[model samples]
Target: MASPPCSAASNFDCGLEIKTRSVEQTLIPLVSQITTLINHKDRLKKTEKTLRAIQKVGQAVGVAVGRFVAVGEAIALENEELREEMGHACFEARRSGTAIAQLTDVCGVEQSAGVDRCTVFSDKMAMVKAARMLLSSVTKVLVLADRIVIKQITSSRSRVLVTLEQLERVSTFQEFVQIFSQFGNEMVEFAHLTGDRQNDLKDEKKRARMAAARAVLEKCTMMLLTASKTCLRHPDCESARINKDGVFQRMRLALEQVIEIVTDARPGAEPKALPISIYNGIQDFKARVEALRDCVYCVPCESLAVQLEALVEQTEDFTDSAYTSHEQRENVLQLCHATRQDTHNLVATFSQDQQSIKAREVSEAMELAILKTSHSVSELRRELHNVAVGRASELLKIHSDHAILQALKTAGEDGNLEKVADLARTLTEQREQLVETCRLLCHISGTEPLEITCIHAEETFHVIGPQIISAAQTFALHPNSKIARENLDVFCESWESQLGDMAVLLKEINDVFEGRRGDKRAYLSLPRPGKHSANLKTVKATKLDAEELSTIAKLGLELRLVTSDVDSELERWEDQNHDLARQCGSMARVVCSMALFTRGEGVLKTTLDLFHQAELLSEQGLQLCSLLQDFSTQLLDEERVLMVSEMEKLAVSCQQLQACAKTPVQGKSATFQKVDSCIQHTKGIMTVVASLLPLWHKLIRQCQSEHSSQASPQHWPDTQLSPPLKEDTLNGKGSNGFGVKSLEQHMASLTFLESK
Candidate 1:
């Protein structure tokens, strides 16, 4: 069910507070129709023109309310818990619509008859009573729909938690595999539901919090698979038990956070003191020492010494870790000691010139000390980043070679237990190396989110090692069992998938260390096809520089506005599978990606990718014209002409967009125009789409007679439009718990099932 609009209709207030973009959008036309009918008093001049206007508006409102009530009744039929309340609301709304329609029925007949007929609507209080009934019942129905959405999310979460418990308690490889498959589907459904909820959220902090919890689940799903396998492989191994248990515990905690966020429950765990990383120390120390330039002797020199010592002390987290290399530990210690000495010297300079604080000699000493300290800390931070990111990069390259996995696969088939044992031992050593590396990286990863990712990595490697061992053992026991071999293969593939995921994590850590946030998914999303796909000996980054990004910020914002308008139109359709609706939705999705691209934060890598998508959007726009022409059969002659003309304009804009996307431009000057023109033309297409969308929607509802109220075009459930999909489609490898197809597909399928 759609959430109620955040703000009720202008001039009409409903007490429920519902805030979602989709719901707000869908209600715009409905509210406009009602507002027109109820506000005839705003213009008291009831001349011939005014009477005609009121009659027309009343007819539109009656038609709209009839269709809305039909949908509400269908929803009531499907959701038993909401049946009685929804049915009452629908009945009242239908009655109010009928009264208003009948009162306005003869207001525009022949002059003398129209005068006599006007008495039916002359009772102002009756019209007012009907308006109130319409507004109140509509609000209640919408609020009830919002409740259903919340309930759907709660049920999905419940399903996931139940499957999670079954997974944790499983023992044998056979049992674990069966339970894990169920766990995976439930996770995918949970992901789909929460992802929708995340996108629908008006609160950015809530969205961000939801995103973090979901990321944990995404990463942990793989870890859970490997950890369970490892526990089965070495049931008696203490480290394996510790590793698997840690993964399950973390996953459970992340799950708890998700449910709490959805239910709006207060967090149960008290917030703990955040760990102080070297990066945090460097920033704090620089801020403190920089302040000394303003007030040298204002604070006690002892305080400066203590603060400097504390900054030096934070480095111990890195230097003292077992995973820190000998060379790295030495470099860190030297830098920390040097930073302490330089800070002490700066403090001493201030102390020595207490009386003549402005003396040049003392000033020079302090300045020199400050410069030395800053340089030392900068070098210290640079070294730490290199050790952490460089080690991860090296490990990834080494692990990319899957020799151990191949040998295990062959040995398991050949029934070579001794060979499998040796391979398992080799895998264990590699796991130890990765686990320690995660610890070292986590020490300097800096941000809490990155740190959480690092811990997840460690848990994954720690657990997957034993899982591989266990899978090998199972294969050795059932050498001829195809299912056992396949199980072993799945575990091995998960290890490789984790390694690939680690490579991504390392890059993210590097981007953060360099202070670049998660803004370049587009570069990674776009394919470097043709010549670009080759391993270049040397080439420039495809990403736009800061200046280019700034130049396009206004255009990007406009892109977001227009595409959102297009999405708003699509949201009103009950048959989201309607040709025009699907076409527009697909275009809106690409526009969304392009808007993010303009901000240097999406999956498109270059202007070329943006052009490619613009071309696709234009093609979809032209196809929408064809669809609209076919759908015009339901509209009146003049209405068809108006809608068709508007669509023709959209098609023309689409042609311009298509031409702009295909045009080749070389230099920076030409390239900039090429991209700007493409996006600008697409915006033009959307503006046309916005104008005609409501008319098309009106035509669809016009077909909703009593005989066909439950037909496809008028039938709406809380579910939006989506393609059908099987549950096992979610079993794709390395998907991070989401299906290979879009999450919307699976989310749609759940509603589809309910409707069926």
Candidate 2:
């Protein structure tokens, strides 16, 4: 700074130049520096403009990039949501794009390049459409699954209620088992459908409900199975208690499971207890089961036991009576059947136990009692049947006796004395047989023989006694002279003989009936008698007491009146026979005298009278022959044949005598011959008649002997006359005046008598 001041005076001139030069140098540098500064300022202004533009461009690019990034993130998030919703449905929709590629082939697109390019845009479009369709389908599936779950839960609950009701109503072991088994099957099916996790359901609440329903069903099924097992093991009242307990436990478990499921479905919620109604229902069922068990143990057994004991006492008391009525017997049978039914019920109750020793013993005892009682009833029925049959037989015998007595009365009224005698003999034989039968029946049945004999005797007397007396009176009073008193005498003799025999037979039967033998047991144990032994013992032991003998004597006295009447009628018949014989002899004498006389008016009148008398005598002889013929027919012996022949000869002789009397004499010799023939024929007729009497008597005795040999009773009527004899009698053609066969011997006899 000092040098610049010195240069300012000497330096004014020198400093001026130095200043100028310094100015030049400084100006040049300033100018140069100014130019550089100007250029730097312009460049800095351009750089500032460029920086503003760059800033604006950077802000626009940043905004556009930010929008693109936001769109990409939104698209990615949408794709993730679609994947979660669609599942397999989206894949199925994408597979549909292959169809569009196939359609491009129809447009002439080649398989190499055009085919690959043709479906590119279409494939992307199809993928988006498929995604939307998959979402819709998934939404529908979730709705259907929720509905199914709700329905299944409701149905399961209803099924459980029905099963419980059925179980409560079950009466028998088989019924309980069947119901339990059905419930078990239903539970298994429900578990199979609900427990399956393969189905892709979206509703969380519905799935939880289905799970709870399945668990409850399973628990109920298990409880039912346990009850059935207990019943099978012990089929008694005690088993019912066990079954009820099991059901209660199952109900509790099922309720617990449902509560747990409900709590799980509702997050942050408490589990509630079962409803009051459901709890009350379970307790009610338990009480009902207990009541049924008590009734089974007490009611039926006690009532049945009391009834059976009463029936036993009644049956024992009934045995003391002498006779049991039909109503009483029927009541006993009903009691037995009721007792057996009660035993059967007891057996059914204890069937499951293998060691019911006391029950089996009681059943065996009841069976034995039933068998013994049945046998006793059967025996009583058999005895009653035998008695009924015997009574029927006695009635038949009485009818037969009445018929025979009627026949005897008819024959007597008709003046058929020989028929009357035959009927009397038949009646006697029948009575004897009846008495023998009564004796045999008494012996077999252990009845009173005297009682049976008395009944038979009473019947015989009532039926036959009056008939015999009436027949005898009718015969005696008959106006027919032809039925000579001699024939009646013979008939009375025959009746007397028959009646005597019947009386003897009845007495013998009574004696046998009264005789004492051994006890029934001893008699049955003895060996059976042979046929010969039986025949030999036909006369029974007669050890009757005084009273018995007196009774028999009284019965015998009843026949005495009949015998006395027969004798008196026989005496009257003998007188009548003598008168008839005298009248016949007078007629024969008159006929012989007429043959000796001339053929004048007076002689003719006498001959006519004699002829009328001969006719009367012939009619009487014919009546006698008819009676003898009846007796002969009854005899059925060789003597019967002889008697019949003789009677026919006598009838023929009578006819010859009438013919000779009726014929006119041609010469003196002829007239004498006729008279002699007439006399001889008459005598021949008388001889034949006399001969027939003895033959008739012999035949009657033969008939009686034949009837006595037969021991069995006559249960049916005898055969009527033979067909040939009936035909001959009805034809009205006379054979030797006998109304039967004509004999050549009779004609020869007539010729011989004429020749003599």
Model 2, total clashes: 1
Model 1 whole-model lDDT (C-alpha atoms): 0.66
Cα lDDT tens digits for candidate 1, 1-756:
122222245433355455554555556676676556555564366577867777787888889898889999999999999999999999998998888787666455545653555422365556666766776777778768777887887888788788888878877655554566566567667766776776666554455456556655654554565556555655775545665676678678777777776767766565443456667777777776766666644556557678767766766756776767899899988887887788778777766655584643447676677677778778888887887777778878887778889999899899898998999889998898888778767767777656766676786788667867776776776677543565566567658756765776687778887778845432122222342333323322256654466446445645655564565456556767766677778878888888777656668988778888998898888888887777666567887888778877888898999988877655554566677787778767776665566566656665444225354443222233223322222222122433222222222122100000
**Local distance difference test scores for all models:** 0.66, 0.37
lDDT of 2: 0.37
Cα lDDT, model 2, residue 328: 52
Best by lDDT: 1
Q: Highest TM-score, which number?
A: 1
lDDT tens readout by residue for model 2, 314-333: 34323332233466556555
Superposed on all Cα atoms, model 1 deviates from the true structure by an RMSD in Å of: 20.3
Model 1 residue runs over 4 Å out of place are 1-152, 163-189, 199-254, 260-268, 271-274, 307-311, 320-325, 352-362, 515-756
TM-score of each: 0.48, 0.18
